[model samples]
Target: MDLNLRKAILSNVSGHNTEQLEATIVDAVQNGEEKMLPGLGVLFEMIWKEASEDEKQEMLETLEQSLQHNQVQ
Candidate 1:
């Protein structure tokens, strides 16, 4: 059987509005489950694909700052 996990994830959240999407992301992060990672990755991929160059640069800067500030276990 051929499985497309990204497509499946996209399909699941296809019709969600901003509020619903924010809730999904909040729940996933709050729950901190490994299984939720792929869904988050899919969401990030969607954002990355849609972002403009300046937006992408800002996101990268934010990510870099976050990584620099956060402590790893």
Candidate 2:
């Protein structure tokens, strides 16, 4: 069996506009299900691929701060 999860996810949301995409992300995060992580990862991969170097740097900084804050708890 050949399975392409990323392609499947992208296809599922292909026509979604910004608002719909935002709602999907918010719902997924709020639901906090283990099954949603792969979809999130696929979305992150798309963002990372499209982001400029400076944008990527800013995202990394944000992620680092989040990780650091988590460690302090």
The model with the greatest lDDT is: 1
Alpha carbon lDDT of residue 27, candidate 2? Answer: 91
Model 1 Cα shift for residue 36 (angstroms): 0.5
Tens-digit lDDT track of model 1 for 23-71: 9999999999999999999999989999999999999999999998996
Compose the digit string of candidate 2's lDDT tens values, residues 29-66: 99999999999999999999999999999999999999
Error of 2 at 71 (Å): 2.2
Q: Give the least accurate 10-residue stretch of model 2, judged by summed lDDT.
A: 64-73
Name the regions of candidate 2 deviating beyond 4 angstroms: none
Q: Candidate 1: deviation at residue 30, Å?
A: 0.7
Residue 7 of candidate 1: its Cα lDDT?
94
Q: How do the predictions measure up, each by TM-score?
A: 0.94, 0.93
How many residue pairs clash in each candidate at the backbone level?
Answer: 0, 0
TM-score of 1: 0.94
